[model samples]
Target: MYNLPGLTIRTISVSETNNNVYILTSKTSGAQVLIDAADDAPAILSLLADAQEDTDATTHVSAIITTHSHWDHVRALGEVKEVTKAPTAAGEDEIEAITVPTDIALGHGEVRSFEDIELEVIQLRGHTLGSIALLYRDPRGPAHLFSGDSLFPGGVGNTEDDPDRFLSLITDVTERIFDQLPDSTVVHPGHGNGTTLGAERPHLAQWKARGW
Candidate 1:
């Protein structure tokens, strides 16, 4: 559990794919929002149960945000949604690939609030037509980015050998994420460990040159 003044971020790695399930909770209200119900239904539910202990209220998940519709990213979405009964949200273009119906179609610059915290949506293409990254800006600290699979520690997501897709992803990451956000921002990717923007910023040229 990562505790901030008003929020807590918890990460659970699931399945053989090592998909990362993120649970963002509001400390004051105990409102919770889950991102990417990845895989392993039993494991995911256990993590949710542990988080619920922090609140005396109903402790139900208010919403489930699916970063993309990739099979690995949503393998357990339906199961988790059944248990939590939380509204499911996903990018409009990627909705067709999701097994569960998307209650809300998120797009660029859209904001959704859970308790006192607001998450801004950023549309990033390449990995999929509607890949998105969620941004949470805390008043006292630097911003936090749930970058889905659009970014990772060494480089961006797989482009399937498409140069055009790689270009699009690079442009979006530069203009929409890197250019606008500070280097101090913490990035929690869809898989693997988290990294700060400062750590990955200097290697942009290397990533671009490698064309991954």
Candidate 2:
């Protein structure tokens, strides 16, 4: 129940892998944003239904945003889209081959306005070629980050497929995300529990020491 100024962000856990699917709604306009449609159609559908119920009004799911296009992150996207009839948005590079209606092509430092809230997209390419994270300053809660598979608690995203690319992703996390946001900012990662920028900073030295 993180209360952002004009937005309410709810993190819903799905799948055995514990992937997090976020439901963001504008408190002022009731516009909905779904982040990461993980591999569970029933769970996602149920969550949307609950959101509509709780809001007591028909909430339009404006977009289904995928942090990346990996199978684990996007398995339920088509079903969710079919059910909600929301446009799916992703980084151009992330969903290269997938033919989905991309309402927005996110890039580094791009700000997307959804009703009353503004979401800043940060490119984080270590976990995948098109991995991206979102940063926003909510009026109710502290600044928030939706860090897809780019980051985690006490660890970083796995880059086993490409060492050089992994190193670059780690660097982006350190400089772009950690350095850009305040210590009080809350990080809601794609997988695992939430953490703060302050809590994750102390481990930066340790991760850097590992030499990617």
Candidate 3:
């Protein structure tokens, strides 16, 4: 749970994998966006329902955005989308893998705005070719990054031991994420818990050397 300036963020873990489903609601407009409909329709629905307490106006999910095309990240995509009737958005390169029809194809650096919140898409390749992270500039404090499976606390997402893919992933993460963003940025990962860039920034070279 979070009480940012104009936004309210609520996250729930679903499925055996402990996949994280995030609901971001604009306090002013009550526009909601569901991130990574990972699993358990009942739980996902409940999370959305619970988010209503954050705003005065009617809280409606305007978009269901997928971080990547991975099975764990999208298991409940159709059901959640059906229940909410929200338009879906995903990385442009992942349109085919995601299966669900994506109403908005997100590209790197593109700003996707719904209601008062605007998320900037950042493409972090390798865990999956089209894996992406969404950045929200909070204005009040540190920026928040919905980093999906591509990024986590310890290191980058699994590259399956392919050195080429691993390099591609690490390179993108180092440049697009570590280099561009500040150390205070908060990273909300696809699974497990959250971490800050400052906590992980010092290990960039180590992560690269380890070749994960």
Candidate 4:
């Protein structure tokens, strides 16, 4: 229950893969941001419509933020962008064929502010060339993390794609994200159920011992 000032976080399951598409909104301003668009066109469109209906008429998607450029993470980006007419943003190396917001390429320890909440983009490359995790701290509730594919419940992201990259990602997670946030901080992964940093910390040694 990490409640940022005016921010509302909603997660939707998309595709057969169960990719999680997160929608972040400002309850005060009615501005919205989307994280990942991996579902089918119809499903995403329905979600957008539902979100719009729930908020004010001016409530429109401000941007589409992709945590990574993998096909599963961006399968419906083009369609969603066209429908919402919002700018799309991704890491420099991970952006796909879509138009990227080069001017605002988020990097390690970089903070991007919305209407009321501030998001710190952390470089967690390993899940992909440009994978990133977003950390949000709000006065109302606990801190929140959008950990993309770089982290999950029992362990870190998959390293099968690139063993070296996975190792680096794991290290980044340990020293950067895990070390910084409070143990109770909530982690919203790119897929599956949400978890807490505290629940995952005790196993860090086991994960590191296993190696990438």
Which candidate leads the pack in TM-score?
Answer: 3
Total backbone collisions for each predicted model: 0, 3, 0, 0
**Candidate 3 C-alpha lDDT tens digits along 95-139:** 999877899899998998987779999999999999999999999
lDDT of 1 by residue, 1-212 (tens): 67777778889999998999999877667678899999988988887778766656555688899999889999899998998888999888888888899998888999988666689999999998899999999899989999999999999998899999999999999899999999999999999999999999999999999899
Q: Is 2 or 3 the stronger prediction by lDDT?
A: 3
lDDT string, candidate 2, 6-104, tens digits: 667787888889999998887666788889998798988777666664454567887888898878888898888998888888876776844555667
Q: Candidate 1: what lDDT?
A: 0.89
Once fitted onto the true fold, the runs of candidate 4 whose alpha carbons sit more than 4 angstroms away are 1-5, 52-57, 96-104
Q: Which sections of candidate 3 miss by over 4 Å? A: none
lDDT of 4 by residue, 1-212 (tens): 22355677877888888999888777677777788888686876666656554556457777788888777888888888878778777766665433433334667787886555468888887777778888878676778899988899988898785768768888899989888888989999999999999999999999888875
TM-score of each: 0.96, 0.92, 0.98, 0.89
lDDT of each: 0.89, 0.82, 0.92, 0.78
Q: Is candidate 1 or candidate 4 better by lDDT?
A: 1
